[model samples]
Target: MRFVLAPSVLALSALGLAASPALAAQEFYVGEPVMKEGLQIVPNYLTGIQMSAHVPGMEMGKDAIHLEADVHAGKDEAHSLAEDTWIPYLTIKYQITKKGSPLYHKSGVLAAMVAKDGLHYANGVRMDGPGTYRLTYVISPPKLYRHVDKASGVPDWWKPIKAAWTFQYPSKSK
Candidate 1:
């Protein structure tokens, strides 16, 4: 009446157990990824933190939520950027509003950051509590000057792009 697991299975089980803590540390609610102007934008959120210690120029506060944006190059062959590459040096601004409210609950520019998940823009915001809310992101092109040869230059960056999503706070998984 005894069961035995294969060596490979045991190894996989040990690896999963070892990685669970890092994977379960943060539970996030992710919005649908939007594609526009040759770029893909994804919005997500998790519990907030006192990030001043880690990020330069970030204020210290116990914000309600840590919002993030993942911007990547779209699958467009015309552009020089490789598909799914993280696009850096761009300005991203976020605004949050309750679904039924006319006024914005919070709004600010997100700082570029690197985390376990990779490069993205993120910021903290204090929420009024759990509810349905609308999140909007306005992305501006990278401002760095690039020296390009006429034959090798890529197409110009897209104009300011806006993407929005509505998500419920205190998501079911969280």
Candidate 2:
């Protein structure tokens, strides 16, 4: 006997495959510094800073994104790391853009790092349900000195960067 598949069934199957974890694995990318909010946010790779992120496996009621970062003096470091020098403040701003969903745009500041010196990590950023999301990482460095922008009043720093990645969040509709 021969079997035939219906269009609806085919479409559903394709969707299921697309939502598989293998296709939605963790994503990583490097960001280049840009002037924004009057600070230089350099990428870990370039500024002797190390950063990484991972998407936790989707569970019955929980899915999160974990991140870690570390900073050290690079070859020709820009800022002074002398003993008495003030520690440069580091912060991360994240935004999630959902393609076709009623969910409104979501963004917030990550909790302060538990470890202060260099190494930094967080539990993870939570998502609203599951679907395709565009994640943007905006790293902000300490403002030791600023170059004021006459037009916008926003100052510029040594090095600021932005990074982006797109990934699908598996839904629980299997």
Candidate 3:
């Protein structure tokens, strides 16, 4: 029997570890459409460098898609922090405005991908060499959203919280 673990399921299974906010910095994209959905496989911060586009200033939109290859982790401990000690991670970022999904709150998932473990899940497929992985994802509430600030109660740019995948690299250490 085959089962697909949806992104929400995967997020709950890992107890939010795979997509832990503590594991990564929250990415906010401005000028994103009120509603957006798509797949993106971005380079983990550990890959010897940060993708220029991922930098804070780069403009992202609802239709933006990126496919990154040549994956190799950096040695710096801080940069590797994003992997959450997990390597071969594919970082997928998406944003949604509050107008997209009604009743949208932080109680649900943001983004996720599935491995052999199941749909919208974590871990690797035990494959060798750099392989292309299809990142199937889902943004809950089916709409756009944004986070309100604590100090000022000011909601920043409309965005769906970022979700990351740390596909354990083929390492015996892990």
Cα lDDT of all candidates, in order? Answer: 0.72, 0.43, 0.28
Instruction: List, residue by residue over 94-126, the lDDT tens digit for candidate 1.
Output: 888987666647788998877666888887777
Candidate 2, residues 1-174: lDDT per residue as tens digits?
112345665676678853322322233333444334333333221111212332233112234444323333343333334322322466667666778865647565443343324344233545565677776766666544553566534334545456665665542222
Candidate 3: tens digits of C-alpha lDDT, residues 54-142:
43333233222221211222333223223223322334333222323344322211223322322231111112233222222232222
Q: lDDT (0-100) at residue 135 of candidate 3?
A: 28
Question: What's model 1's overall lDDT?
Answer: 0.72
Model 1: ten consecutive residues of lowest lDDT? 18-27
lDDT of 2: 0.43
Q: Model 3, residue 16: displacement in angstroms?
A: 42
* Reference-based TM-score of each model: 0.75, 0.41, 0.17
Off by over 4 Å in 3: 1-122, 127-132, 139-151, 156-174
Model 1: pairs clashing at backbone N, Cα or C within 3 Å? none
Residue-level error in angstroms, candidate 3, position 143: 15
Ranking by TM-score: 1, 2, 3
Report residue 107 deviation for candidate 2 (angstroms): 0.8
Of 2 and 3, the candidate ranking higher by TM-score: 2
